[model samples]
Target: MLENLLPPLNDHNLPYPDTIHPIVVHFVIAMVLFAVFCDGVGYFSRNSKLYEVSWWNLFFATISIFVAVMFGQIEAGLALAYPASESTLNLHTILGWSLSGIIAAITAWRYVLRLRDPKTLPIGFIVVGVVLTVLVCFQVYLGDELVWVYGLHTVPVVEALKEGVL
Candidate 1:
């Protein structure tokens, strides 16, 4: 039924569509994880240098998130093979947008406060980054559920495990 609304699925065995399986999302996810670690270091060490590095990570994440959003949007149109896929896609889209907003707000806060006083920044970083990290974990789980449960998309590792594609 839902398949009637989508383009005919191509069975030519082409590598996954560019939109559904872009390489940049991989790099973006890595950057987000690295940013979380940097934030952790900054919070624990209370060092200005570490805090600055954390801010940079957040900045990178914000930019990458935008790119990921674009690719995800394009992929959504192509991957509507089942009804469950649509629900998972909607959930992922909401989580991604919320996470992007949180990361952007935190990055802006850190940047605007960077020069005024070094001491005040730690508490802000500790609070915001910690909260954002927790949210990121939740988003990660939503992403997993989208892929694993709904069968909306594929990652190389999962593709290998499920299909022996490696």
Candidate 2:
């Protein structure tokens, strides 16, 4: 009865053929990376002007990451993973949640720093930003593996599922 109300699954076995997670996540990834870049440049240039930009980017990223994670959880839950993709999918799920927490904590810490001294950001905070950038890069790699290698939600996989071959 519920299926009757829902839209028919598309070629990807998704209510809408395309996954929204990747689109939202790409924004989160870009914002976080850009925020880190702004911080690094601000630190090296000893310029306070970029701090505002960095703070705002991180602020938006903190919010966007949660949205990305929500879409990811929904899409991943709906994904029909083959045996080989299961471990990678599980790891991606775990890391996605972990990254969201880390981003939120760091954003909170940065907020406190902003409140303490709007004129200057701490060197330690910049260092942590560097670490966050590294982690984000790693997460991107995992996401690429899921899409490019494992082909999760790809046309062929979806077709196989439709054919009862998956």
Candidate 3:
């Protein structure tokens, strides 16, 4: 069968080179944080252009979050996480999924706000954006811990797991 000729999974637990989740997630994070910054500045400065920029950023972020989440799910499944990393991984997974939905909902709400007023944004929206940024930062911390502290899918970690050293 052709399946027998396929390459083995790498130390990263992927068929290809490296993890896609972190790459995608970083983009999503940038978009979200940048969008929030744009919203805050636009709201304070009464700058319509920044509001437009913020809206587009949020819209794109909403779309990108799904991609990020999909890759995160796939990579997490392949990670073969050990006990030390399990709790953090579980929380990250749960929060990642939750963030995808929340981002979508926030984008929808932003759409309504944009339609109602193109030149202005509500302070409440900016407040919510800040809160969302906080949550995103927390998610980032969890992800960082998984990679740096727990060493879930790194080469050494994978080798250790295979050799029963972990």
Q: Rate the local accuracy (lDDT) of all candidates.
A: 0.65, 0.89, 0.90
Q: Write the per-residue lDDT of candidate 3 for residues 33-63, one digit (tens) a residue.
A: 9999988887888778998888888899898
Clashing pairs in 3: none
Best by TM-score: 3
Model 3, residue 67: C-alpha shift (Å): 0.8
For model 1, how many clashes?
0
> Evaluated with lDDT, which candidate comes out highest?
3
Cα-based lDDT at residue 145, candidate 3:
99
Tens digit of per-residue lDDT, candidate 1, span 1-166: 9758656533322234434434656666666677667667766776557666666777787888888777776666555435545666787788877777777887787778776764446555666666776777777777777667765544453344346543
lDDT of model 2, residue 50: 91
TM-score of each: 0.72, 0.95, 0.95
Candidate 1 Cα deviation (angstroms), residue 72: 0.6
- Order of the predicted models by TM-score, top scorer first: 3, 2, 1
Candidate 2 segments whose C-alpha is farther than 4 A from its true place: 164-166
Report the candidate with higher lDDT, 1 versus 3: 3
Higher-TM-score candidate of 2 and 3 = 3
Question: Weakest 10 consecutive residues, lDDT, candidate 1?
Answer: 9-18
